[model samples]
Target chain A: MDDEVIICRCEEVTKGEILKAIEQGAKTITGIKIRTRAGMGLCQGRTCGRLIARLLAERTAQVLEEIPPATVRPPVRATKMENLVTSHGE
Target chain B: MVNKADAVVIGGGVIGNSIAYYLAKYGVDTLLIERKDLAAGTSGACDGFIFLQSKKPGFDLRLALESTRLYENLADELSYDIEYRKCGGMILIETEEQLKAIIELVDGQRKTGLDVKLMRIPQELEPILSGHIIGATHSPLDAQVNPFKVVLGFAQGAKRKGAQILTHMEVQAIRTRTVRGELKVDSVITERGEIKTNTVINAAGVHAPVIAKMVGLDLPIIPRRGQVLVTEPLPDLVTSLLVDAEYITLKLAPDHRGTDGLGLGFTLEQTASGNLLIGSTREFVGYDRRTTYHGIKAITQNVLRIAPALKEVNIIRSFAGLRPYTPDGLPILGKLRGVEGFIVAAGHEGDGIALAPITGKLIAELVVKGKPSISLDEFGLERFK
Candidate 1:
């Protein structure tokens, strides 16, 4: 696969990286956002969400818009996952 | 007996409120109804850019020009502050092809008596922009306003003039009655109850089709979703509205760039509160109002290209709104052929905020006087047939 096909514009993650992540069982956009940090930038994946959705659809052979949009958590920017997990657990 | 009025304007967005305001001013008792809070639809969520630069070279341009002129004095006429700023707009051209297109656009604009000029390395284009650009076209008559304030002002003004504006009043169906040989709209059944009236105006924005269907009329209006983002206030990086011609082909103008279905794009603008409005994405994904990562990146990347200095600005929030799009990109206004007393003022699409005041005035004229001051032949509902 061509590296020029950028799957995630936020982390500059290429299609190859997403495909590799998928192979490692990173199925959802949130999962990919956590693992590869593909959408964990200033925009929080507003730019890369649709592209990731399309890539997911093409790879999985599903309709594009039918794929549920990424869950938009408040403070829309990137947050420390550890902090969230610890706060919830406490 | 149920409460009644001469006319009921459905959908309490800018269009509905403006229509109700004008109607009441004309001494025609009116009622304005909204399913949610006023301006809850595209009216509240959009950057109120009253622009003429991006309009297609013919009839649409004329509509924009007329609306732009009306917006110039709307704040004063309504005796309310709508933050109407006649700040010029620039369409940055990155390639020779785009420059050619800009030239054509300028030619059309000049023919229509618009104050437009193609700027090649303009000196006035300063601190507002922080990137390399090949060329740009400037239109001095373009302006911006706070959509929320404008809608509120219209609604308040309408209420002050005897129009009963009711929020959270959803119209369930339209009740028809025969007067002599002619069929007329008698009342509107709401979720709560019914309000009897002689006339009904459909300004339901994205839900215009649904409301029209209640009266057995087919209104071919589809929801075109546009997502917008807001950045924390910076020192006025973008003074005048800036756009990219190539981005226009992608429908990714600077104000509403990211969330539309178009690939990585951004439109940047500065509000009176000093916050930067960055946007957006345009997609034809039915009524889904979800924002995607691709939409955000598209806007961010485009914003960076236009103003690299904005890299440090933190985006505070992001949102999506749907524009009621017609197939030919023109609005469906005026009364339906077979449906008596049922008029449509929806499908202004992305231009709704800009076109609201004029559309209201026109609808008021059509309803009260049986014809409009301007030609409504092109905007008639019969075009769908």
Candidate 2:
């Protein structure tokens, strides 16, 4: 992949940026995610998590399976504040 | 990995990393062991407010004041851009009862020579705030920084100064030896290997008790859950870190019963990236860090009551963090009485980010000089007894 190629479309992180993060001692997917904000967008790494793991493995020469997936927090999908609450216009 | 170090600091959040940075800078052979990556715990999942006004007057407030002063030049000193913003802070008051409570709190803080005042919400912030918000307390000293960057900066600085930072390495056991009929820390045992050391510092945030329990000590630290909401990047909707007066009530009084078994506090602040980060609900769910519908709903309802215009803003994400709550609000710092060569620097709870620098400096001072400039007597583990 070219350095300019975008890996995380959600955050617009490119291959070069991720490689820089790896060089900065980010060995895992979560490490790269935090350093480059690759998987921190609205999608919350759903889209770019595997891509980031592969990139990290390639750069660090680690097995792809060994790299853990980035942490997933809930609402699994984005929900509106109004929808979450029950009482309306209090 | 080396078999020996002058000091071993456990955990790699902002607290541990900051301790490592200071210890390494002071010319100690420091080794930091983190179970996960840096800022992966409470430090990563929370807001970045260096809010001095919210602190209880006297010990806690004085410590925050000193820490805020250190943060002024921290970025330059660490050679890292932490996205520091000294935008000040406010505590919004909705009711006359809240106003009365805030006045008393502000008066206590003022007596300590802190530059805080109770006043109407400034005109610039007036339009965004709901009309129900009657008043606010403002302090120029309150500030914020990128929490992740701060952790990374400290870790990097520590590494530059020859500290060995081993991430993903969990300390399974703390090995100790009784020399001349006195027990002393001997080494830290990990799954991979044991690193021999005479000094061990626990800065593990909420998980400090787990490490303490390994050494036959019981730390009275429990995890209090807080859930926060984040908005999509937008124009500067809020400048300063804003919290409801009720948040202080929930924080200061542990037994203060809140609505629906959850302590909901309105904390709204716009990040440097332009996203308005709002939060939060303090609940005692016993280390269950999941954001529930009940929590999300409570927080949303509470926040909207203070800033109704934020209704249109899209919430990008919501997350939860476990604050290390001690019996007292203050952290358990300094060495334990029976534990030789062991020091504790955890249990800062929500104030960890604000007090990181001072905690680090004080802990390092205790390790190196056997005395911190600021006495840790009040903050020691003995206080709980």
Candidate 3:
């Protein structure tokens, strides 16, 4: 892959950026996410999560299945603050 | 895994890495062991607010002030861009009672040599804030940094200074021996092998009590969980580290359980990348670091109350971290009474990011010179007794 090719479309993180984070001892998707903001954007790693994980596995010489996914937090889908408030007590 | 070192620091969070760096710089043969990667716990999961005004008056504020000075020169000294930024901070005051309380708190802080003052909501923040937020307190000293970079910087700096750092190595046992009818840390037994060392610094954070238990000592540290939310990257919305005045009340008052028993508080910070890091709910839920639906709702409600304009902001995700809480809010630092060569520097709770550099410097000083320049009397482990 070309170094300039974008990996995380939401964040516009390039392949070079992901590679740099990997070189700096980012062994997991969470590590790469925090280091490069690759998967912390609108999709919250949904779009680019697997691509980055594969890159990490290939770079670290680990099996693709061995690479863990980035931690998925609440509000899995992007939701507005007002939506939460409007929902009220269930 | 070699066999020996002058000092063996346990846990590789911000605290442990800082201690390792300072020890190595002071010419101590330092070896640090981490169960996981650096900042994998609270340090990585928490926000990067090096806030001062919210600290309890006297010892806590004083230590924070000293730590601030160290943080100012840290990025340059460590030769790593920890993204240290003194963007300043503010506390949003809503109620008349909040204003009065903040005034009294600011007065006490000013007396402690902290440069802080109460002020009207600034022109920039006026549009975003709700009408209920009548006033604010601004301090030029409160700053922030990238917590991950800070931990990595310390670990790298320690390595550059010839200190040995071992990650993915869990300590199974703390080997100690009795000499002259007193307990002394002999070495640490890890999954790899036993490391021979006379001194052991416990910086295990929320798991500190577990480490202390290996030596038949019961530490009073409890895991207090805090949950936070992250918004999608947007144009600079709210600037600086902004918190609700009630956040201070929640932090200082132990009995004041917040909205729905979640201990909710509103702390807003815009990251360098323009993503707003909103937080948090403080709950004592043992070791569970899971975020709840109610916790998320409470924090969002708080954001809307503080900055109604943020009602439209889309939240990307929410996460939780466990803070090491003690009986008193202050961290447990300095040596233990019954143990020789055993020093503790954990239980910083939310102040871990703020106090990491100074804690490292002081603990290093305590090890090298047998005492820190500033008194550790207030932070001693025996205070629980």
Candidate 4:
């Protein structure tokens, strides 16, 4: 984990932050997601999810397949708050 | 010397990457050819929602369920983050008609052993949703991931396991041969040169139909365009993924404004970045990936009705991608009837991101071991015939 590199841009989470989370007892994939917000950033973890998962595996001495994959929810893009309000006005 | 391999997988989206990863993990010599970078198609553009609730009953639901399970373990197996979150999912019901439709969907889900429940009042939706809600149905198993990272992670893992990935390599044609009067796929003619291989897997996303046509196969795949909008970062306002059943119905409805023979559905998801994802419009505009104001407005209207607080969120950008749709709303997988060593793994439409893991695993198993761990007859190309 690089000290200068940021893992999650939205949360300012870094690779060190994620590795630390794993070291501190984040076992499940979601546990790491919550503690470090590694995969929770904009770009929706599209850039960092696999990277974090690899780091977690290295820290936990676990097989990659044993660690569950992240779940995907839809609207797969972000909607405008204005759009939500305006559409309802109709 | 040009290396020979057991399989050559075209396309490097989640499907192609996943197939390559699994095949290599199984110790098969595999070569993955991509026209551009990984996840360059719909996999790069759309939200990675591994949803099972909205699938049609029977075979579709069954396939989605199995795919969901595979997603659960993909992160560990691939050693990639993939941002997999099972924050659950909700379908908001604004009208009684929508509620009734949801009930039917719930019934269908239950028949397939899925745990889907309908909320009679808005109180039961408290933990899952915020703001106004008429009624809603909840599914604990629904989840999301970042599409780009997942595909790249698979590509990385496949490469690590001895799979050769050629980026910026486009397949110009599929070369077939007559060995003792029997036709077979001999190799692929690419922009670089000819690579002779025993097996060819078409995981080409929207461009799959073109590849299939090269082999004299009719895939019945059409390009269904979907538009999406991205907003600037905000607080974590949405905990679970929120969907409006009306939107799904409207998207699926034939007469909906955005459904230009495709569908009209808008989904709202808040990313870890504090930004929100509003999507999308389904139109049958062939390979045109441009976004339109009309489509954005329709999607915005739908989002505002569910969460009025979103009125202040700043929209930064919007984009669109093409979903590879089939006539029966199912993807074409497995080998075509007459084409030996030629496999089809396209037409997943919007569900490509959701079903990538399972699709890849199944295709790898079918190609390497002669059969998939699961029965792929339902997803086979024969369904079209």
Model 4 stretches with alpha carbons more than 4 Å out: A1-90, B122-132, B250-262
User: Candidate 3 — which residues are off by over 4 angstroms?
Assistant: A2-4, A16-20, A59-61, A88-90, B123-126
Model 2, B134-248: lDDT tens per residue? 7888888889898889999999999999999998789999988998998899999998899999999999999999998878888998898889988777877677789987788
Q: Taking the tens digit of each residue's C-alpha lDDT, what string does model 2 give over A1-90?
A: 799999899889999999998887788887887788888777888888888888878878889998889766656677666665654332
CAPRI verdict (incorrect, acceptable, medium, high) for model 1: incorrect
Q: Which residue pairs overlap in candidate 2's backbone?
A: none
For candidate 3, the docking band is medium
lDDT of 3 at B258: 76
Instruction: Summarize candidate 1's per-residue lDDT along B133-210 as a digit string, tens digits.
Output: 777888888889988778877877887898887775678889998778777898899877888887899999999999
User: If candidate 2 were superposed on the true structure by all CA atoms, what would the RMSD be?
Assistant: 2.2
For every prediction, compared with the true complex, DockQ reads: 0.03, 0.48, 0.65, 0.14
lDDT of 3 by residue, B313-351 (tens): 898889899999887778999998777888999999888
**What would the per-residue lDDT of candidate 4 be over residues A1-90, giving only the tens digit for each residue?**
366688776657888778776664455555566455565545666777777777778887878777766545333555445644354322
Q: Which DockQ-derived CAPRI band holds candidate 4?
A: incorrect
- Candidate 4 lDDT at B183 equals 73
